[model samples]
Target chain A: MGQKLTPGDSRSNLYNPQLGMTLIVKTVTRWVKGFIFLFGVYIVLYGHLTPGGGFAGGVIIAGAFILLTLAFGKEAALERMSKTVASEFDSLGALMFLMLAWLGLYFGGPFFVNFIQRNLPGKRFHLFSAGNIPLCNIAIGIKVGTSLFMVFIILSVLRVVVKKGERRMVQMKRRGE
Target chain B: MVTLLTVLLFFMVVGAIIAVETKDLLSSIICVGAVGFGVSIAFLFLRAPDIAITQVVVEVLVLVILIRATISRDVTAISGDREFFSMTVSIALLLVIFIFGLEVFKSFPQFREPVFTTMSDASTNTYIQRGLIQTGAANLVTSIILDYRAYDTLGEATVLFTAILGALAILRAKARKRTTDSSEGNSDQ
Candidate 1:
């Protein structure tokens, strides 16, 4: 992430109020972001009933956040979900999925035994159906969504180290350096 | 359907070739994006809406990241020293890989036929045939991934975590550490 400031611009664009894209993009983002998020949630929740599962839904969810960041800059996006929080959620999702497997094992079955379906199978094609599949999907969705968003943020924001009266990033050495 | 798929794949290949030949990095990225969207549409035509949705979203995010990367950076390709030789070698390698891939696919079951149903075990067939009844899930794909073969999904999640860990390790290097030490990590705030 190279930060390009114009010739007369002193303050970095990161701190600028007009940091992001043009007015049309921002306004359209404001209108469409909620729908994108809702669509993502719908895909995640109905994953058992539909063609999409956790991975696709999670990517859609991350796209909503990425849209916000692209339209209104990183600040607005970070205000909604910060990098640290996203990282925490990422781990939490993976842990939740692992916990589901462990629970199945503890309940007198092998790992990931679909314990709910074994006991009381819900009605087919219903929202509360699919035993533990929906829960697993939700966990995967959260994990993937946060992980991808964090990757985008990490890649987009460059660390500018102030060193020796110079304001520039210390470029990491390439291979064979 | 086969003809449609062939046409789609042909366009995708052309887009890829244009992407490689284009000097402008932005247009090249967009052309690559076109190739990806073509694959997504092809996935839909193949009746894999799951994959198509994922492909489109992933493609959009990749384009976003790529454009962001090039926005403040150089947008033109700086011709390297060994371009022609590398291109020849890569094309040769791709042909070799394609032949090997065809061999691998020849050993697999035919398309649109569930391979598990052909096995000897009756109980396995029961699970495969009556998965909707057993799992109470409408979508067989979801049941197959999250119920029957959950360990695979778990492994995939772990792989994703490991990839993110590697990315963070490389991206957050000495520059971030020194800045955080000096600024008490309040720079983001």
Candidate 2:
């Protein structure tokens, strides 16, 4: 219990317990990330009735993951959603969007036609009022959110590799000198 | 509104200059983020809440990415020898573009004015006048994007998908290894 400490000493393992930011950030994120994610879902679901739609909501969702990654390191964030799963979900989103359009085509209408709206238009200003819009918004939200997360994860991983490569180059140059 | 926009634009330009001229990569990223937030606020003043929200979140993510990439890799001595010359040339080009933009602004419509009602074509007018009844959506922008211009949304989604594919292809570790002897490449996998 009597461990001496100095400023900027990450090796102490007391102030810096893990491979992430301070404990305060991690604690705050644990409390706030769920709300951020839920707000993003709300924006996506109510996209047709509100100012934000799929893109905004999707970006918000990705922002939550990014915040988690920043606060708790990549390993914790990847535990929630691995890179492979993110990529697969990205593909699934695009496929779902395309399938929606193709279903419109198969139903004897033009591509992206509002067939559901024409047949059974629900009550106005309601959740299911727009025929294919909510579905499209969900698809786009899934696509944009997962792909952006993947992009962030990939870029961060690449940064590590780049740093290592640069260090190796510096070491080689010093050895040559 | 115009005054607010002018102030925001001025601050944004100042922030951009500071971001570009600074040597510290971290402070430069923060300055760029300030400029992005200013742009988001300007979007709000322009009555585009959708763009504003997207811009704010995207800006934060981009800032996080940029800072994470360059925070530990400080390269203060990497400035180009012709930095002053490049800066002068860019400023001159910007001034010329600003003059041309002012000329183009003369022919544009009034700010914040809905243009659909003034046009003679009644077909396009239906979206604004009867967008809710037709699409059963309250938000006109959402109805326009997901219904009236759905094919365009499809194209945008395809574009995003292609862009992510390109990013993954370029950034994957195994794809860049030309030789099998590199231990670093193997370890990454």
Best of the candidates, lDDT: 1
Model 1: residue B128 alpha-carbon error in angstroms: 4.3
Please give, for residues A1-177, the per-residue lDDT of candidate 1 as tens digits: 233545464434434555787777877887999999999999999999988889999999999998988876776688789888999999999999999999998888999999988888888888998789999999999999999999998877653433332111222223225
Q: Report the lDDT tens digits of candidate 2 across residue range B87-172.
A: 79998999999999999988887876656657768566888788888888898888888888888888898888888778778877
Off by over 4 Å in 2: A1-16, A161-177, B80-94, B122-124, B173-189
Worst 10 residues of 1 chain B by lDDT: B72-81
Record all residue pairs in model 2 with backbone atoms less than 3 Å apart, i.e. clashing: none
Give me the runs in candidate 1 sitting further than 4 Å from their true place: A1-17, A159-177, B80-128, B177-189
CAPRI quality band, candidate 1: acceptable
Candidate lDDT scores, in order, read 0.84, 0.83
Q: Per-candidate interface C-alpha RMSD? A: 4.8, 3.3
The 10-residue segment with the lowest total lDDT in model 2 chain A: A1-10
**Number of the predicted model whose DockQ against the real structure is largest:** 2
lDDT string for model 2 (A96-132, tens) is 9889889888888888887788889999888989888
